[model samples]
Target: MKIYLNDQLVDADEAKVSVFDHGLLYGDGIFEGIRLYNGCVFKLEEHLERLEYSAKAIMLTMPWTRQEISDAVCETCRANGLKDGYIRLVITRGVGSLGLSIKNCDKPQLIIIADTIQLYPKEFYENGLPIITVPTRRCNPAALPPTVKSLNYLNNILAKIEAQHLGYQEAIMLNDQGYVAECTGDNVFIIHKGVLITPSASAGALKGITRDTALEIADELGIPWREANVTRYDIWVADELFLTGTAAEIVPIVEVDARKIGDGKPGQITARFLEAFRRRVCVEGTML
Candidate 1:
């Protein structure tokens, strides 16, 4: 395997970062999870754009332009002979002293890894996944906006651990106000009376790239869609429930909190959106 570090591609075993890096010390970093299909990078521009936004939000300057970053990603994929895989792009505050100030850091470090990732099994995609709502509420936006995909994922990790202990594959997190935020690593969407609904950004949900694509698919398929604040009850009685993410793609949620969602099966609209999403990705992407 090959990893893109700084500006050079190196063997995975040789790819290394400083132990004093603030990204590892204080979680001062941002990242993006991208997908490549048939040598094509899916929504490369959008992912880069989001990466830039996150960097800016965290005051981390990028040494390379967006185009250069994109090229590096393609180059790394080619170097690894990856026709289909996942890409993890990370920008971290470089080596720094044991202090809480960014002034201690010198520069930023960039790393890109292209590898295969199976976020969920094939059977889960077909039979739908059972999830639970955890007590770990999402981090407040005022503290750290969910829109920025940062390296500090302890909140979600705790929720995931709770779900795992309970024998569930994933966990849903609510905002401080008790509104449905999202899942551990995916955006949540539910269908109610033919309308596609998801939490707005203000609800502490990450503005996911795949979540936006799903909205576009809904529009193309003539399915009514809107963003609004949703509660646990909305999901409990929703006609269908699903999640979207760069890795998770689109997968149905059959049960939440052990209660069956809409006859405990993948709903018709969910299936339609999933099919449309798959077709869209195969034909629409940046050629590697």
Candidate 2:
């Protein structure tokens, strides 16, 4: 397989970065996981926009223009002979000293990797999966804006740990205000009174690309959706629920905290959205 290291493509085995990189030491970086479908990159522009926003919010200098980065990501798919695959684009605050200061880093680094991704079992979508609430609260917005998809992911990792310890595949985390935030790497959504609801940006949820696409589809389909502050009580009584992300696109959640969702099966609305999402993957966005 081939990897994109800045402007050039090289063997994955030959990819290297300095140990002094602040991205490794202090998580001074940002990244995006993009998807390619049938020679087309799904929501490529949106992903790039989000990446740019993330870099600007974190005060990290992207080493290249948005167009350059987008071209590199598409080139990566070409190099891997991929018609359908995933792209991981990473930009790091280049070599910095041992300390937390960023001055030592003179340049930023960019890496793009194209590969296949399977975030969850296929059966999960058909039968749905169970998720439990974790004690790990999301970072307070005043402390760390969750909108920026920065490299500092220890908070999500801790929540994942709690889920793993309980032998569950995923965990739900609340914000400091006790409002439902999101999952480890995906945005959360629940169905209440035939309406789709997800945590608002103020509720500490990442504004995910897939989440945006789903919302658009919901609107086009005349399915009502609202960005509100969700609570444990809201989830418990939800008729249907699902999570969205670049990796896990519209996965159904059957039960939360031992409470069975509507019929404990994939709800009709969830399935309809999932089918629509599958169709969009191949037909939407920029074609390479």
Candidate 3:
């Protein structure tokens, strides 16, 4: 496999970064998980925009232009012979001393790898996934904005560990205030009283690309939807529930915290959103 390191493509085994790099040392970096479909880079521009936003939020300097980064992504996919796959684009604050200060950090480094990823089993998608609510609350937004896709993901990882220890495949994370935030890696959504509801940005949910797509699909299908501060009670009584992300796409949640959701099966509305999402992937955004 080939990896895009900085501006050049190199053998994966040869790609390396300094141990002093702030990204590895202190998680001083941001990243985006993107998907490619049938040679088309699904929502490539949107992903780039988010990356840029994340960089700005952290006051990190992006060394390349949007077009330059986009071209490199396409090049990496081509080098890996990837017609359809997952892309991980990372920009790290370059080498620095042993302290938290960034004064000594030099340039920022970019890395892109194109590979295949199946976030969940096919059977889970068909049968619907059961998830638990973990005790670990999401970090306070004031402490670290949830919108920034930073490398410091230990918070979510801790919640995921708690869920796995409890024998669940996925888990939901609530904000510090006990409001439903999102899952370990995906944005949460539920259908109640014929209305599609999700946590608003103020409620500690990332403005996920797939979440936006789902909302657009809802509008296109004439399905009523809105964003609000969701609670566990709302999910318990929800007619249908689902999660969305670049990796997970749209997967139905049949049960949450041991409470059986509508019929304990993927609801019709969730199925429709998934079907429409699959259709859009093939033809949307930039093609490699």
Cα TM-score per model: 0.99, 0.98, 0.99
The residue ranges of model 1 lying beyond 4 angstroms of the native Cα positions read none
Please report the TM-score between candidate 1 and the true structure.
Answer: 0.99
What lDDT would each prediction earn against the true structure?
0.94, 0.90, 0.95
lDDT ranking of the models: 3, 1, 2
- Pairs that collide in candidate 2 are none
RMSD of 3: 0.6
Off by over 4 Å in 3: none
Residue 192: error of model 3 in Å?
0.6
| TM-score, model 3 to reference | 0.99
- The residue-level lDDT of candidate 3 at 118 comes to 99
Residue-level lDDT of model 1, residues 64-122, one tens digit each, is 99989999999999999999999999999899999999887988998999999999999
